[model samples]
Target chain A: MTLKKATAYRLSDNSKALLIFYFVIFAVMLSFILRTTLFTSSNYGTLGGLDASSMIFIFVVSLIFAESFKMLQQNGCSRKTIFLSFVYSTIILAVVMAVVDSLTAMLMDIITSNYESGFFQIYQARYQSMRSAQHFFEGLLWYVTAYVMMGAIGFFITNLYYRMGKLLKVLVSVGVPVFFVIILPILSNLTGGAIYEGIKNFFDFAWGFSHGFNPYFSMVSASIFSVILGGLAFLLIRRAVPKQ
Target chain B: MKGIEIRNLSKSYGEVVALKDINLKFGGDKIYGLLGRNGAGKTTLLNIISNRLFPDSGEVLVDGETAIENDSAQRKIYMMGESNFYPEGMTIRQAFRWSQRFYPSFDRNLALSLVEKFSLGLDKKMKSLSTGYNSIFKAIVALATKVPYTLLDEPVLGLDANHRDLLYKSLLESYQEHPRTIVISTHLIDEVANIIEDIVIIDQGEILRNQSSEEMLKQGYTVYGTAAAIDNYIADKEVIGFDNLGGLKTAYILGEVDNIIPPELEVTKLNLQKLFVVLTNRRALK
Candidate 1:
């Protein structure tokens, strides 16, 4: 019962942020709508990247650790409850955002046939089916998986920082970028591009873009990605004590 | 069966030992005063019981359930820490709203009434509140929780005299209205002497004294007289503290008072604060 309340509060926190996101999105969409109606001869740009924006928003929201942890822990919640609430909140937020984005994308297309730039259109070649319904369903799943993965990664980063001391945190903050931006490239060059090829091949296999244009591989991979990151996050917070 | 049980609880921070093998039980719906000096491991014990910090060894059980990571067990408890755990940007009203959701037994009306009594601005953000008001706000919420066991660590850390009096009265009122086990950890023993029924004294990471307030106070006393008389009287007795000025002296003794006393020497009953002072003095520590 306590877990239920905690999960509800976590979901409500994300939903409120999601509401602000939609308000801003609608305001932007309304401006384009006005331009199209006022200047019939003018070409209005397509506005259909809500999925990407929502995914980014959720990831940013998941980066919050201190406030959420303090709030839940204050209410007599254990670390287990806090971690579970966070994971459940991420899944629920991803599902809600995916459904809302898919419906909005479809609705806007019906209202104005000039709609484009959705995930379905952006990755049309990756999907075999050309049917709009198939696109909507596939895009929905794809959005959910992407948002879940993004949320997991964001949460993992924040939890890692929370668990680290000042020196370790600084070392990690600089070491991560240095490794990716400089060392990885140098190592890839020294390996005769084998490292890059290996990474690309791994992505191809995980996303199922190589063989049958299958999205199940991406979906399964995303689930596994979330589980692993979530597991590591729990370990980091398992013995975490609040700062003075 | 219905209390917090700690068995061999120990916690250390590097070379500093915060708590050393503490075995205790806070049972039933009674008010307990945990008296200790600064860094006497009072806060550490409370924090460990609340699961905010992990102990090096031992376990804590609330009622019959382990409190380590059990939500059901935790739901029955609440600890108002010395530090502000709520988000700084959150308003008192927002906190109350969320508190209602988290605690099924939370009394929103009680919180509102206490807020009005304390004159705390409901819409003011946590960061904007003064130290006194911050303590008052958290204290009000803690009282309204109505949980089975409420552990308050430094409940009146920054309150003024008037606010402190009002808080003590309110605490008594709440305790009478709905009896629950309330553990108050503080060094200000005199202020809470009349409020707490059971008193527990800890010093240097160890449990020094744990008993009823009346019984503990009855165990010690002060004898005031000339230096020579006071020294002679306490020589055979167990003396915990002493104060001297010129030829006059005061010796705090821990034992039953004798019926026959020297005419020049005066004997006064020991108060909780004096006993606590003598018991936790540096000389008493190992």
Candidate 2:
């Protein structure tokens, strides 16, 4: 019952407005892009497109976390219930968004079937390489994982801001980038670039392990990152007090 | 067994102690007036009980179950804190609907009736209401949520004289109809003196007095007469405070009243407001 209440609260008026705004903007922009690419002679075969829906999904999920946590907590909801409800709502939102994205792509393919549009051709090639069902399901899974990761990160950052004192907040704001941008360079210079080399090597290994390797491994890594961020968010919010 | 039991609850913000080793129990189907000066941990205690702020030292139990993360225990309580917790841009009707979702026992009819009584617009967004109406909205919700225990922190913060009276009457009506425990924290002591059956006085993060209103009233009295007569009458008694205008004077005495009073002196019961002022002032002097 608490979960249900929390979920209902999260999907309140502001969230609904955000969802509508994103969908309307995506649909209008997609139509404009398709019309120009199909009708204009020069841009017909060289059609370029970006996954704008995915970007909107990430932003929508982030805004939901940024606004809902404190409001729900203030309304006498337990932190555990709020976190669990967020998980459930995020899963539902992810599936809905992914399905919409896939349907839009399929519709675009059908509209530009006569012309060999670059964007539609790329999707068709993927559909042929992997069965259409596998392609659509894999795309959905990727979106779901990516959205969850983004949402969890957003929640963690918002919780951190709430939990930090004024002095600590200032320190974090100034210290983090200064450490990497200024202190790291000086340390690298003094130590014959060993620190820089170590950092680069670590990033190289991470990139290769996640993106350059099997797609399944990258999905697992995204899931792991999401869980870690979710755990951190829970810890920060478990005992947080609202500002006076 | 059905009331909220708070055990050794303590909370602090850095060096400032908000609540210190506080142990309090709010039980039974009676109205309680939780009186405290500003910064006396009244709101802090309510927030802790509602799980909006975690206690540093101890636990809160509702009917023998922990209330921290327990939904069953939390559902029995509805706290209308001083802060605005309703979502922005939500109308009063929408708020009522969502409140019903969270608290199944919330009485929509009662809330709507209160809106009519208070002359609050159901279509007005929460953020658009005046301060007094904001408080009225929350108070209406508190009165309508027929939970076992309701904790109200500064429920009448910005209400005027007439609205405050109406709210008090509505509060009494609700309590009489559905006999639930209601704890109210407010500075308007005299206004609620007749309404609250029990009184809990907290000062400087400590429980100074906790007793029935009648019993608390018995602890103090006042004598009015000429300055000389008043001084003479209070010569042998523990006087908490005094007021003087020209030659006339009033002395607030803290203890039993004598059966035989001087014929020239006038005696009256010390009102709750004066008693609160005297007690808190005496503590400050110490």
Candidate 3:
């Protein structure tokens, strides 16, 4: 269905309510940034001082809304229809988040730059990492991408729960991540950290690309990983037979 | 006008055969009572026909098209079985909303009316509702969907007697208003006997009986009298089952007893419930 006709809630009012609920929660964090005194137009191109907690807030909101994606599959909505709508909405929501984040960061940068000019000048002399302020820009891009990926993970798990029975589903949902978190350290120790270093280098490049300070190769590497992982998710939805 | 046709359809769960080389056809605007004992494969057959599950062998056809994952064929049929797949935290209204989205023919107004009539609160979360209320909510969803071929597996399992009677009455009213094909797989035989026009009795992974209820009723009757007299009266007929207490005996015979039943024998009519039980029980022993 085309986006114009694809009102997610049209099929059921409950679906509509869910979509709205998700949108509102997502918008709330942006509202906080908008209301902050540091927000200004002059610093639009810079990363301000929003901490990881706020970023995580947006991610959590995205995850909650992703529940509707599973609901669509459960209700026998076609694979193509549900997937496309999900992607469309995700993109739309991401775009909105990007705009809000940029505005908030710019305002904070302008306010902070003006308020503590002397302090920054003195601090800049002693600061070693300010050598890569350009990386900050790339970091913003990484933020949006990571949040969307996190949302995708939530969506995938919900779909998995829908397809598998209780015991297997619970095991897979909890086991896979718990296994990775626990085993990664031991694997790093045994492999002399080749696997660990490779993963770290990958995310470092991703961080560089988001801040617009990374080498062109780093951006390409991040893009490749994003495309491969995102494509796998799309395939999962495509091949999904209505599993109840 | 056409019906679901199954040919050599078989399904197994590990070592047990759920359905064994089953073949049958159901057609037209008739209410079919899919009577079977608990593991007789009633749900499996219905699921396969509705494209909810896959079969290991053979093919099921709806209007001459394969039913496995056929969207158009599935669109013509709706299966509301025992499993209620409504997600956690969804309210009754929310369930209706999602149903309306996926099912093009779903009637929101009708669903709302049923919700009110059943005394189900729209705001009540599905998980919070009692089992009977949950079943009622699903029944409303099925009725409002208004698909041509509606399959309800154990439609009123947890319902109280009054609610069950109300559901039966509403079902008849709905069916009359939109005379479509309805396949009701229910354990409550007597409750649905009067409304069901056709019957398909499944037993031990096979179809024991598939016939018009009228014909089945005519063929199945109970001959009551003294143990010796009832046996003598039904000697020429096929006896599905017999019960004797003290010297009084009642034998459930298959086929008509028009002129042959002795004057001394008391014959009472067999409804769908008795016919289904005897047929299913006999097939089980065999």
Q: Point out the worst 10-residue segment of candidate 1 chain B by lDDT.
A: B277-286
lDDT of 1 by residue, B152-233 (tens): 9999989999999999999999989999999999878889999998988887888888999889889988899999998788
Instruction: List lDDT for all candidates, in order.
Output: 0.86, 0.78, 0.68
Candidates 1 and 3, the one with greater DockQ: 1
iRMS (Å) per candidate: 1.1, 1.9, 4.1
Against the true chain A, what TM-score does chain A of candidate 3 give?
0.59
Error of 3 at A230 (Å): 4.6
Candidate maximizing DockQ: 1
B220-251 in candidate 3: lDDT tens per residue?
A: 78778998887677767788787889999888
TM-score for candidate 3, residues paired by index: 0.76
Sorted on lDDT, highest at the top, how do the candidates line up?
1, 2, 3
- Residues forming the 10-long window of minimal summed lDDT in candidate 3 chain A: A114-123
Per-residue lDDT, model 2, residue B149, is 93
Chain B TM (all candidates): 0.89, 0.94, 0.88
Q: Kindly indicate the candidate among 1 and 2 with the higher TM-score.
A: 1
Candidate 2 docking band: medium
